[model samples]
Target: MTSLKLVIIFATLVAVSLAGVVRRDATDDDDDSGEEKHHGPAFLEGLDAATKDKFKAIFRDHSLKGDAKDAALLKLATSVLTPEKLAEFKTHQVEFKKKREQWKADYDAKYAKLSPNAKKAADEIKGLWEKDGMDRAAKKAKKEEILKSLTEAERKEVQDLFPHRGKKPSRN
Candidate 1:
């Protein structure tokens, strides 16, 4: 599971970095011509000025340019992400799914034993989660209340089962 999570996280980072590259290249289009410009790899756009300069030096070292540079970067990425590594990730993913299912089953059993009012609140939250018109802040507050009602073990299990879902992205 950890391996799968890491792959997902890495893929997300790569996509975001590539998006920065695309956005930067899009904005720097030549006014007089329709030809697409080869700005280094999309990953470079996400770096700070100093980091960019450092990478520029490295690019010069290899004498990679335009399409060749893109191919080089792609080759580098593929080489690092080997089939064996991906197979390990798949194994971890299967283990994680099994564990998450067990946790969810436990959560259901624990939820059934909650006090009536807590159960009511949980049901309401579940209903709201299924539908979509509620105010975001109100839904968040209700969700927090529902979590607070859980036993410590249940809460921990829930957190472990979905660690990334509720988190906000960190500022770089």
Candidate 2:
């Protein structure tokens, strides 16, 4: 592969790894909501424990710095994302994006038809989310209240549209 391509790949992996680590650290509290934060391929869920441990070891190597770090990361990415696997992942991403857009459109259409009270509740929840300085639990509780305002069918439709809802999260 081209040197620039390798550099880009390495940089992207490092950034994702760093973000995951930081997010994990920030949320490592007793009050954490039982939610798994996943920001990568679904195949990552299929990796065996031994392979996952090897990947962790690569990131934990403190001696690797600068270009060495980049090189090591690139090597790791190359090994993990084989040509066939990468092709499948790219296809999956494209399909997922299309499905997400369709779901958003459906939700907008359904929401536009809600009764005045339900609409008002949804608006209040949106306002709460957009405002700064609100605690997560409070916001979530308020949002749930808004959902409760909806009819049973409407509530089920909304839950169905959300990819992360109504399904057990895979352990990282």
Candidate 3:
């Protein structure tokens, strides 16, 4: 009977020790996982208040809620721009405008040197080509809108070029 009591006591002690060890291990694992939950600093450091608000508004519209969204937008804004960056962009735009104007002047001077009949023909061709391009774009947009309103069969009946379904079929 004494031997049996001794065995039972020893088993109990072992089980208790194991349970304590298991609990300690679980606590340690919890701590390690908790470290990953730490949040970092915000990204909107240098922009003006108005711009930051605008950025936030855009972020909200894109369904980017919370600090993470704000941080991402602020980081992008900082990386791509500053007052200096804006100034640089404007300067490049001005330079490009000047270059385009110079090219146009040079082209006009060359056109003036051409024979009158040649210049007239060139102008006529340019006007006709521009008009054709504009007409094509307008027709394309109209066709797309019409197609959106159509059943597939009706769309298929519309000619690809002029999109006039009533026109006489062209001979290839």
Candidate 4:
């Protein structure tokens, strides 16, 4: 075999060996500490343990992130489920997506009505919340500063984007 082919074959063998050695019992709780982790909805309880463990692997796949991960996971999970379970699970997924879309639309409408300064403040807070580097305390302090500067009406409009989740958190 060619030298390059030998290297590729050697690398593949090493990877396969390492994977076998590193593999853990998927039934053992999703975490290293052996605590059961729930990756799917409660309805998933109807699924067999092996199937449920398959879902857990999708959630833990580090290669996917953000919306792409969500979409890919949904597709994979749907493909993996049995016909009987797939129908209900797909329906649930559709309902969830509808709710998320509605929420985003509602928030967008409210944001469009804000004053220029209010828009800027809201955007800044969103940026800080998503971006890395800044400590959470520092980010919150900066956000609270902008939030406090808002007119009461703007505050009401921009307060907790996910208000349905709970009371507006005390910004203090």
Candidate 5:
């Protein structure tokens, strides 16, 4: 639909405008200025300046997504990543995956106890987030509508449990 295309276009524009400021460290330049530099993750901290820039560019690229993105990153890492660092990073990755799985399981347990209406609203909000071509305003409106359909107690519980609730998204 024309509206869907327009929404995607608008979202892209907003992203472009924010891109420069979103990542101060993603840029290739070495800043000698007094301002504090954004330190990369612990694993990447061991890499040299030029190597860091190369990896950063690969990571910043929008054209690479999903498996393609992972492959690109891995190829770059293969070149310069030390064996010890690779083992350390892999350990961290496994730990992260486990933590995420546990969190999802805990949330699912909580979700199972929710009222039918609450579950419906939660599903609608999750769908809004997952749906392609959904602009922020459209998602916000949809979420508000879903929340309004619930009773006061239901609304409070839903809002309290929401992943996005009470947090401003990170600019970095």
Candidate 6:
């Protein structure tokens, strides 16, 4: 009789544990479903025509603003987003931030090894980056001048020395 009672108690405990695991799994599924709903294209389809037009304009030119831009974004969000999709987007944003930080660290480490003259030139470039509200035309001209001064061999050597500096892989 005691053995029978013990068996029954063990069986009950096992069933209860299994039930908790199933509940947790269900909760996880619900969260994933919510995220999927937000990321899915169905929400985008919900925006009004006017909102869609505004969104298109913004995409073509970033300078567009005022109520039109606001309306378009609002429409896009309303049409496209569920709470779940927003959460998923937020997750991606967090990952991007982490990557940006890592890249900055690598850049700083690479910059630390530059020769004194090279460092001075890099500092001048850095100052340009630091200058707030600088005119874009002047900045472009300065950048062009810097590039124009470098001989092909010097550019190639620099690119070789700093693998991250060039857009393309060095042939040599």
The numbered model that scores best in lDDT is 5
Model 3 segments beyond 4 Å from truth? 1-81, 132-172
Candidate 1: minimum summed lDDT over ten consecutive residues — where? 38-47
Better by lDDT, candidate 5 or 2: 5
Candidate 6: where is the Cα deviation over 4 Å? 1-81, 148-172
lDDT of each: 0.61, 0.67, 0.54, 0.74, 0.75, 0.58
Tens digit of per-residue lDDT, candidate 6, span 1-172: 9999999999999999999999887656567433322222333344455644554565455444444554555555555557775555446446646876786777678677766555555566666755667776887587556645666654333334445555766647
Compute the lDDT of residue 17 as modeled in candidate 2.
100
Q: For model 3, state the Cα shift of residue 101 in Å.
A: 1.5
Query: lDDT of model 2 at residue 124?
Result: 78
**Ranking by lDDT, best first?**
5, 4, 2, 1, 6, 3
- Against the hidden true structure, what lDDT does model 1 obtain? 0.61
Candidate 4 residue lDDT tens string, 71-170: 8767866677777677777777777779878988988887888788778888988888776788879998988898899988777666755478445564
Whole-model lDDT, model 5: 0.75
Estimate, for each residue in 1-172, the C-alpha lDDT of model 2 and write its tens digit: 6999999999999999999999878767654655453334554445565655665576566556445764675566567876776565557557766876787787788677766666666667668867667887988987888788788866665454344655886556
TM-score winner among the candidates?
Answer: 5
lDDT by residue for model 5 (1-172), tens? 9999999999999998789666755654776653445466566765678888887897787667556876777777777789977766667556656876787787788788888888888888887877768777998998998899899988876776656446976766
Span of ten consecutive residues with least summed lDDT in model 3: 34-43
RMSD of 5: 17.0
Instruction: Return the clash pairs for model 1, or none.
Output: 1-92
TM of each candidate vs. truth: 0.36, 0.43, 0.30, 0.55, 0.58, 0.43
